[model samples]
Target: MRRGCPVVAEPLDTQSLDAAGPAPPISEADRSPARAPFDDLASDWRLRHLLDVDTLSRDEILRILSTANAMAEVLERPVARTPALRGVTVFNLFYEASTRTRSSFELAGKILGADVINVSGSGSSVEKGESLVETLNTLAAVGADAVVMRHPASGAPWLAARTIGGHIINAGDGQHAHPTQALLDAYILLREFGDLGGRRIVIVGDILHSRVARSNIWSLTKLGAEVTVVAPRPLLPVSMTAGAAEKEHPLSLPNVRVESDLDEAIVGADAVMALRIQGERLSGKLLPSSAEYARRYQLTAERVAQAAPHAIVMHPGPMNEGVEIAVDVAHSPESRIEAQVSAGLAVRMAVLFLLIRGGA
Candidate 1:
């Protein structure tokens, strides 16, 4: 884990398993056209904070997707380094633990030649009675250009954004949102099917507490994908109607459907995204047992076969192998779990590039 200056007091021992290491050198073949597909959107994107996908416009979403596509091309080169954010400093201030997201952001910043720092609540002033606002202000005071943060509290990123002047990238904040994860998932699907318009995507497993599902619903719907969320009644939100008066419920976006029958949801689907059960966040009343959950909602090879012949499988990962997805299905040729991870790197790189340099 890369350490940064402590928030207020002494630094804590915040070593992470997903530390960013040295990237390979960029080769001549890695160079591509300098122009970005979403240059217009980039210029128009005045917001310095990336709080959620629900607030992003279709053109803005496409701009990030196009920028990610460009970054993917760079990754294929011998040297993947870019000086897009060479002098910028980025900090990962995670109040909650994450393997894929934290590592992805750290690596993205490093590959773009930015100074990346990792600060965790466990070993920082946050553990010593400091407030979130205080820590964010301290980071800004120390010259941070951007802050990628994850917190167990919902809307924590939004709160931080209101307190700080630097760019705020929400890694994950409770069940409210995981915007970048959604963008990368869309990137993978777009690469697979070329177009998302009119395609069906089934998101299975725990829905009530999944930040990934919330973000995916917003982004995928904007891209014109037909989204169906399948889960046991306990795991599904109480309401699925868009623009509901309740603010705490899961979003009811247009073109989205809620189903309890996992089998019924997968039929004719172009892609299936199996979300983890999120056992840690559960209240113990929503589920019976892991065995039962697996029997009812697990994405087995047989269930996958019920979908379109060319349908693909997806999982945001740290997969609860047998609980929500069968092991064979997760490792199947149609599975895009690994591809999502790769896409995350490029997507995050694009996000940092756009926020720091303002465009390609």
Candidate 2:
């Protein structure tokens, strides 16, 4: 069934079938010069490689999302499964505990017709001292075609991608990049604003430990969006990630900026993304207090409006509603947090299609 507006679920195993409306269909009239047929196609292809978000270029990213748009169509069909990835083996190997990301990756694989295997940290062989690389090799040895991984370490996705031959899609890594999250975020921006190019999008909260923030920064900027990172001084790292440095990412790409004041950052922005402050990452010196962080960095209704009238509010998931956002502000039509979740499935499906179908 087509589900919508992904929220942070804690192994509920129950799905909401009512959230999504049906997708637009590929029609003979859709052949009009304005429409891309793939945007309406109901079936999907398999993707093989998912090593890293950086592995995808702008054109590649567009194509992957277009494919995902089609996969979104399949959600409403009588039978959700297609032969797009029949017989393909995809493994969900997560060393860290996750709810939505893990479930969505599993859902994407199944919806695209790939056999799915979910391996969690608890049941996995980590207690035996088998390194991540060795565990990945074991999966490959058993005929795995792709590995979707979430590790506690940043850059683990890239390392796994290099270490393993199959597509290594990063679910989430330590304070590095969550490529799929970025793709979904970009898709939401694209779906709403048409193009993120030259648009000002501000991300507030914990930039220091957010993989979502890092990936979204890189992805949005590559698409020509003007991006800014706003947080207390404590939320930002002393340096950029290895991925950003490796690319020699010029400031002009996203016209990136860093600010200490959330109020100032929201002023004149087209969009504002509020990031969650992980309780786990907070240390002795990083924050004065959660209450203080809430007061200083939170996106209130007044703050959200401080941006351009066209600005939309966003969050990756598991929102500290009372903390990072006012409850009234989270459900505002301008907030695309739910849309981001929907787009996530579409984006992941696209990545899988591209890698498995090898860009049919």
Candidate 3:
């Protein structure tokens, strides 16, 4: 129930759960190839299923990354179309409003050679009793093999993934995990730094409300990158993700440091990812103002320089310039904002290709 809290089908075995707070341990099952479950998907892009990160072990994570890296190659090619998912019918069932995520996913599906359709709740059957599951079922009946979904609820994708016959790829689910965003960000780092192991990276700004931050930490630290989370106490989640995945949380990483001091967090870091301050979730008397937050935690040039000179700046799409980062510097070459977007499509295409091909 991490993303907007989808109803869980079964109660978790709490006794077996690791008592550690948000960001649980990375299972050896999840470790990159050496593990067999995921190794098979490496060559088989037709691998279906985008249920939850919990189900796919670490090696699967690397398998998808390897698959996504290949998808990225498609983006670099002329016209960027592959028959991998050719003629596969797919659906974009977005219960939440989005501009870039929806567009990128639809573009990714089209590029990977799949038939795409978009559905929004604003003026659709969803206005009726059609639950998220109900609508998705209808899509499946109509021949959809995959769904790139964005919902206001956190665990919506997980619930839908189980409810539908087709595979589910979470676009942005509440403040919960955004797997593709995490994957693309990881891809950007992989392309830049080679391997994430031992690299120092800091994610500054709204950790609690930014799904990007949550998902990024899991992928980043898993590959051996050092992580740091800097945010105001109120803005950060009182409790982060729990259960077996605890080790992946940014705060739990052995080398990761949690600091309220923005400047200190960024100092000498290899990369700094600034998450847009989500004003919607801010409750009574929390943050002062956009201007105030910008002045304090905002990644202006001065604060960035306080960190290592080599540190690169990152942000997810539709950035709140004055709020989380300064407008002038957000577009710099070192800023992989757009690159992150491009990689998102490639990685998502990889996810879809796996699911659709398998389901087909």
Q: Which candidate is the best by lDDT?
A: 1
The list of candidate 2 runs beyond 4 A from truth reads 1-48, 240-254, 280-283
List candidate 3 stretches off by more than 4 Å.
1-47, 52-55, 240-254, 281-283, 358-360
lDDT of each: 0.79, 0.73, 0.69
| Candidates sorted by TM-score, best first | 1, 2, 3
What are the candidates' C-alpha RMSDs?
9.8, 8.1, 10.8
lDDT by residue (18-116, candidate 3, tens digit) is 122122223466344443222334444444666445455555666566556556555655566655666678889888888878888888888866799
Stretches off by above 4 angstroms in model 1 are 1-44, 241-252, 280-283
Q: Which ten residues in a row have the lowest lDDT in candidate 3?
A: 1-10
lDDT of 1 by residue, 44-146 (tens): 5465778898888876776676666556655665776766677789999999888999999999999878999999999899999999999999999999989
Q: In order, how many clashes per candidate?
A: 4, 13, 22
Model 1, residue 282: displacement in angstroms?
7.4
TM-score of each: 0.85, 0.83, 0.81
Write out the backbone clash pairs for model 1: 12-123, 25-79, 26-79, 242-252
